[model samples]
Target: MASLLPYGDVDFSLRAMAGRAEGFGRNAIGGLHGPLYFVTTLADDGPGSLRAGCRRKEPLWIVFEVSGTIHLSSYLSVSSYKTIDGRGQSIKLTGKGLRLKECEHIIVCNLQFEGGRGHDVDGIQIKPNSRHIWIDRCSLRDYDDGLIDITRQSTDITVSRCYFAQHDKTMLIGADPSHIGDRCIRVTIHHCFFDGTRQRQPRLRFGKVHLYNNYTRNWGIYAVCASVESQIYSQCNIYEAGIKKKTFEFYTEKAADKAEQKSGTIISEGDMFLNGAQPCLQTQHTEGCNMFHPSEYYPIWTMEPPSHSFKDVLQICAGWQSVCRPAEISTNLD
Candidate 1:
């Protein structure tokens, strides 16, 4: 890979491993701990199949030996202490998606999720009470619901270096404004590519979210958003607005401000933009909402922006090539 930054900067690529004591380089280690579970075929066996490796009780590394697409007939339920590795294979999930419900210590990497539709069809649903989760280097698009929904007290999540394209309501951090459990959701989204996505990239609600070093291009409605007691720390991101697009409110504050209305807080610093006439426009809000710093959780995090342009780095590093597919596999085999 080409050098993306200046000589001495905390590598933007390292953002995936920011909070972990052991670094997560490139791929998120989903079930790569105790034992190795090689997915020998591309067959769907409901929750008993390879699609549901994260639901396994024992600690194991779920790896794909077979290279093909697994079209699900139902949602795949994930368990804790699992790593789903799709490297060295062309693994694609379609027609359905994964659900992480109250699970912990999970990682999902190097998979392609396409055309996921039907009910509850988020690419990845991080449900309530989940913790220590890392979702990295995946390709998510064309889902019926939001691509990713981190809701209901889900915390300690890191979503990085993935490619999100051709979608609307792309990523929803919280379930809804009324879901009170969403306040405990702490997530880190960094170095990802949001390309041609329609909206909600992503709509955050009631979470302490750290968003940094992401490259967004041609969003239909807005790039970043906050509502309902959410605290967003946005730093060092690049937005390339769509030409001929009327709205320039790259950063949006959802819901109207009122004296009795609950509000969300967004602290913006060190961001870049192109063709966005109204980037980072601070809107009206109710007072007394608490603001946060990324260092409160990630003490190693810095406010300093990247030394080089993300445009140059993202062209070669973002998406499936650098994030997923460590080795080439036969996509035509499926």
Candidate 2:
């Protein structure tokens, strides 16, 4: 077991044990208490750019900085009271971004994750028995599965201010459908953006998911789905940019098949701004405990001004040109 104290010292001996790859270096820096270990890749090479490291039982503070892409083909597990801060840096982890397996008191912040080519190359995979985890300000895109997945006994997890895009399946919280285990509980998602053009909207399987102030555009399906016994508090969510379908649909078969579930509610209190240029679909759901409330607004149409006639028309078009005509109109008319 690794010690969580002596926060500032870097143990060079642990480098070899942690499997430091080529082109990456590990150093210990003084932090709050014990030494804090920072693993960095100084090169911009191809595939194998990041150094691989793990903490099973000991406490650690790991930082990965990649100028280019990096791949972690295996699990990057962090134990209790550990902090994995990427410091608003970019990292392309070809496999799982950070796997919290049966751990507690873990915090992951300021990292970007790009998935691998496999089926389960998720940004973060939380296994059963993990608790009190906080994932904040991270960006996850282009994955086969969801960006962040919580399963088994995971509970009390919070995800905020993140951006998820180009995922076949976006955020998922609960046990795998095939596996029979305890459900995920007490999860919160706030102030995030989900651009799900590739797949359906973000989903929550089996937990209490609080979603507020999220922006979803160009989504293929419902912006939010709560299948199992989950309570979703949705407010100030701009769904579908008034282009695609507006209704929130539930897969009733999937919801009913889940063990002893309760249908959730959708609360829309604030402005549901819709650009009248696109058609809108009424919100829909299974007939039961589910509910939908939409704010009333006059659908506003944004009209594009007529094309410029000539220099005479151009003079009249100058003052309002900024907001009226297309940006290319100026150069074209000139």
Candidate No. with top lDDT: 1
What range of 10 consecutive residues in model 1 has the weakest lDDT sum?
6-15
lDDT of 2 at 278: 30
TM-score of 2: 0.64
**What lDDT score goes with residue 53 in model 2?**
34
Tens-digit per-residue lDDT, 1-334, candidate 1: 4434311221222222222422112223344445667687788874335865656688766777678789888888888777776666778899889888878778776788999988678888889788888876788999999898888888878887789998989998877755767778888887788989988777887778887777888888777777777787778887778852422222233333323455576776777766752454455532455687766555454234543454667655555542232332233112
**lDDT tens string, model 2, 74-155?**
6566666565555535545555566778777666655677764566667788887787776655777876666788887677
**What is the Cα-based TM-score of model 1?**
0.82
Candidate 2 weakest lDDT stretch, 10 residues: 21-30
191, model 2: CA deviation in Å?
1.5
For candidate 1, give the lDDT of residue 276: 53
